[model samples]
Target chain A: MACDARGKTTTIKILTGLLRPSEGQAYIWGVDVEKEPEHAMSRVGAVVETPELYPELTPLEILTYVGRLREMSPDAIRDRSKVVLDEVKMSEWADKRTGKFSKGMKQRVGIAQALLNQPDLLILDEPTGGLDPRGMAEVRDVIKGLGRSGITVFMSSHLLYEVQETCDSVALINKGKLLMYDDLARISLWRKGGRVEVEALPPIPPEIVERVQAAPGVKSVRGPDGNRIVVELEGGDEERAALLRQLLGWGLRVRSFKDVEMPLESLYLELVKESR
Target chain B: MATEGATQPTVPQAPQPTVPQADRRTARGARFLIVARFELMRQLRRRRLLILLIITAIFLVLLIVVIQVFRTASADSYSYASSFGGFVPTLAALAATFFGADALVGEFEHRTGYLLFPQPVTRTSIFLGKLVAGFSLTAVTLAVYYGVVATATAIVTRGLPIEIAYSFLLAVLYSTAALGVAFVLSSTLKGTTSASVMTFAVLFLMLAIVTAIFSVADLRPDGNLAFAGGTISNILSGPYPQAYPGDTEFPGGPGPGGRFRVYSPAVPLSILVMAIWAAVGFGLAWALYRRKEMKG
Candidate 1:
């Protein structure tokens, strides 16, 4: 469940034109970030690491400045800044200088500034980093709302739980190398077929273990320890049911039954170690 | 997925209704004034800018009082006021250095570039806008400083000369040249303190070196910004210092051939010198800012 948050940050920066990729191309909206960053990065909104802002500027001023920089007219900047501040729940303090604000408040203003132009791709690099639980939750909720509005949200978090809790599709990288990329639901499904572990009253004979492997849909069998056996099956629930029946009929004295997980941790360790 | 229609942004809810989009043509264009407007505001809001203004104002008042108290035989000369206009560029340059030295560096050191650079605006626009903003504030300070000098001179001579306006224009150009130099430093350094301090060093310390080199070689100092700035105020005092003899009034002067011939920057040449400094300084600063990547 470890995450290479820094690697993800590097990718975002490259895409946003803040950093250049030395060996390969990085593109945003089909425009090469290096050659056409002005075109590509224009549609992106990013909050990298912490929310850094001018301490002297009020939240209203910062957002208005960003809106103006994006070439929004005075009327649009005025209207949009109000909306952005309200979205970040800082409407009341909109006129107050951010110097006096807390980290959470500063972060809110940062998020508000990013939304001033209504960007197409919103990249949040550890948006909740270094926040109290409440602060983290507050930012998390804000990000969730952004995603619902159909903005393509790209967020990086070192916490597996946070990624699982926040992202749609997950990309896991370590040491600048991509480890996995897939639907969030299927990270635990690195390989096909379910693994089932069975505990028996006594060790099944080696012959019985072999017979179980020979059963329909059973791809492999391991362990014939004094008490249990492990089965890797190539079929769905129906095939699993048939294998359990075959094992029971063999009188292997089955005492317990359950599905086991793929060794993702081991797989990750091996992948990282090998890449190293 | 956990993010599917989840997490509420703390916004007040109104009834959901279909709405048309607003035009974004302006938002997609490159304009420095957008940045300049806020940058001007940002410059004005800082406490250091105010402190510099107050101190310069105090210096002008002291100069006036010194003339009033001494009652020299040429009390009606307003000579002090004329010479003081010459120092306006130095003061204005100092003020520019204070604000502009950290102009671009603040964006990165304060981490504001993380927000600022990602916007659709080009870096060229940002650099140009910030220079305009920095120069604008410096101009305001120069105006206030000029006001004191003019009032002081009018009180002594009972009338102000046309040279006051001419000098004011020159001072504004000199101030811009200062900002351009500071911008060069700001864009090259990574930290606010380093950039600001180095700008002061360049304006003062490095200036001494350039002057020394010109003197040791007995060369005309037309290329020096400080020398050009002196000519801006020198015009207000009297005719531009004449050939070879130069301004005996200017230190290390009377030129190489004594009174036989001296070299001082002529009025038009003085302006051209400042213009050249302005051009080169802004050009180099913009180039550095444009190429800089945000590795930090």
Candidate 2:
């Protein structure tokens, strides 16, 4: 998220039939959400934007009610509700009224309610929006578990780290415009870094920076390290070898020269910067 | 109904037993009943119901105290019961306004529909469930009120009149009518508070407008809900009141007499009017509810 995440939530609400789209259409399982919302939404489960539970109801009660609406058998509803409550780690508070629960606890119950019908698609809009660090970790673990259970999870977040940690793929949006969307690994690899850090056995002199900057195929140079120099190469495999040879010819000992960087953060920043 | 037992759902004994939904119509009916059952239990658990119970009890007690203070509480129980008979429909209207008004709007206002609308049920199912829930609770709340009146009347008179049964039926019918009106307002409105206030105003204040309109028109207020309410209370007035031209000037004036004809509809006509309100209001509300998006 470059800024806000309203677009992610609005899209979820529209697909869940809680809101109507002014233009175009959305579908689930080949059924149109606008024209056949009952059919479409039945196949999808969503928890949108700080969903509030009935304060008078317990988690078991709310889940059972939702299951009953889905026409689950009474025993099935009971067992399913218990299973969902356990999945969200609220088995002990299953019987307690949610009126007195923390925001995180309410969010858990909301997630459990969404899981009652066990739909093919589970859409959660900021499932852990305002939780404390510990609360966020708990919810994130549950989400990650759900992600691995063969159920499709579509989660939106403004916290880049949270998305990086919990999501297999990421969609970054800015001001309703999708800036980038790809597998995290693939996106990270697209921008191969060209800078190499040289940890020299014998530290290079401060005046040697100008000579290294003047070396062929070396675009830039920085750092008078304990015994190292960083060289930004213009391109290719030969540039680093030539730069290392030149450094050694100057009576400098290089211990290790390595290209070490993942480009996801750089890519994200570049995209966001370009978009802005 | 025997479904009162079914409504109290527990864990099923069978393991994932499949109930075949052979048709959308049949499926809708089953879903309607399930949601209605859920909503009924929901209302029973609401704290506001308890408050309504308290308010009704205090009103009844004060009524009895007022009658006793007038030294007529000791009168023959049949007449005494009829003296306080009007409270039934009044309570029905009041209860419908208090509880039923917010039933549908709160589902959206409180964002409860976020959980409800994504289910396999249709909007009509949601509306019907809520209507049934409000009707069930209103009936129960009215039951307690009538219970006190009935038990006291029976104890003193040593007998129960068949006409009081008719009166009770009218009260329940009237309650259903009021619920229909409340639901119609709830489905179309945005907020619970506004829906409730407008529903209450439409329930009682409509009577004021009706009275004034008919008074100015020099016509009888036969089609009014309040008129049916009068017929409800009149069923226990020893005999069913007849419809006839009343002692009036047949012209415009706000005074009681010599103003305009007041229509005390015969039992059948009154029942017809109340039924129309119930059917049409309930139908229109369902229609509107189906189109009402959960924008919240």
Candidate 3:
């Protein structure tokens, strides 16, 4: 999900049973959180905000501790610890004290601990919040990999690109209320039509640009600066294909043609604007 | 608007059957042990515990030196060893303060509760588990302190006093009581350092001040934890000291009436009071911790 610094963490905490909601109720797998929190939380793994691990403990020891609390057996904890450490790419640092670890390394360990139980749901709050570009990419890859592996990953992030790249679905939250909830494909499609960016080989004449604008299903056309023109069209893949064919027939050597995806930032701004 | 269930997604996994309610009760017992074992390990790995141990060793060495060099004539085993017991309350206070004072509050203060509090175990199990671990640490320290005193007394007097064992028991009770109070402060306070300092101040300083005031006014200070802990040494004085406040008149001594007042609680009463402090303290700590919510 994508959200600002409002109640994202509070919502995650309440879901994870860290904080009791002042009113209403929350259930996990049909078990009520306030009534039977332990049972409700049994299959849920979460990293709320920045998880503060004990500096004195190694990642292996910490995972073992968490595993024991989860009531996993000795053999299971040992086996799963190895699997999760390798999953987060922390196998080499498993025995080193977390005190000496970088923030990124500790974050990887945090992810590893959350994955230790093979949870059905993994909730991560701002998983890449304090990371450098490389660190952010590394953690984002881990999260993406987990999502592909079929764990329902519910992650809260303010980074639009990160959400665009990582999540299949996005829920935009503002002021403790969900403003928009939809799949990424729908959100990425512009309101009128899909935008297509076409590159032709060399300087195209104004006649060719006019020809492109006059084509069927074309909403508007912009650019041709540096051999590229961005066209807003009325349809999806078939329409884009027809435009590509039409460009070739016009005797303009088309270099590259693809859809220009709307950035998540624009969609977020639009939602926030609409909510206001 | 009551918030209802925050459900987890049910995905098919490797056949780990759901535990029944009866079995969950048993799992809670196992979880309590897990918490206690790891809590003990956390305390053991801390630098503060090592520092406390070093301080304990130094204190023991000094007691040995004073026993051998300063006194040419050895006193009875009970009197000699019970003098060492007078310092037990202080040692207990230090151990409890170091381990117990930040036990619960540190999770929130340092934000480690983000990792811990979401687990399947209930808050009651966590609180009791940590309580046991803190009490265990303090109890072990008291045991070591008494062991040294016992060995030294046996070497000089060639006889061990039964009162020394009773005194050790009283000290252990007092230490657990001190730890209970520390956990209460730990669960209530927002900062770990504040909890630690306030626990030490309340147990080692404030309670003593209250007891002293009550004694000055010729009132029974039996209910005060510090006064209750006084039995650790009072029992060692032999015949259990005076149970009530009274003035001892001296014809030539310098006093308001040439009289010195004495106040000591009966040994049984002190034991009962310390137990109550421990029980009440743990109960109150658990009640507060279980209801606490993470807002930060």
Q: Score the docking of each candidate (DockQ).
A: 0.30, 0.25, 0.33
lDDT per residue as tens, model 2, B31-122: 77877887776777776678788988998889877766674534665566676677776687678877688888887888877777776677
The models' CA-based lDDT, in order, is 0.73, 0.73, 0.79
**What number of backbone clashes does candidate 3 have, counting pairs of residues 3 or more apart or in separate chains?**
20
The best-first sequence of candidates by lDDT reads 3, 1, 2
Question: In candidate 1, residue A40 scores what lDDT?
Answer: 67
Q: Rank the candidate models, highest DockQ first.
A: 3, 1, 2
Ten contiguous residues minimizing lDDT sum, candidate 3 chain B: B1-10
Ten-residue region with minimum lDDT total, candidate 1 chain A? A262-271
Candidate 2 vs candidate 3, DockQ winner: 3
Q: Can you write out model 3's per-residue Cα lDDT over B85-197, one digit (the tens) per residue?
A: 77888988898899899999988987888888878778888887898788888888888888888888899878787778888999999998998899899989999999999
lDDT per residue (tens digit) for residues A1-276 in model 3: 445666788788888878888777776666787778677777777888878888888999999988888777777778889998997889998898787788778778888878878887788999998889998888888888889887888888887778889989877767676666667787645333567888988988789899989999998999878899999887756678888899999898988987676556655555566567
In angstroms, how far off is A76's CA in candidate 3? Answer: 1.1
The share of true interface contacts that also appear in candidate 3 amounts to 0.46
Chain A TM-score, prediction 1: 0.73
Candidate 1, residues B248-268: lDDT per residue as tens digits?
Answer: 333444556443223456678
Q: Which portions of model 1 show Cα errors greater than 4 Å?
A: A1-6, A34-38, A71-83, A175-179, A192-270, A273-276, B1-19, B24-30, B71-78, B239-263
Whose lDDT is higher: candidate 1's or candidate 3's? 3
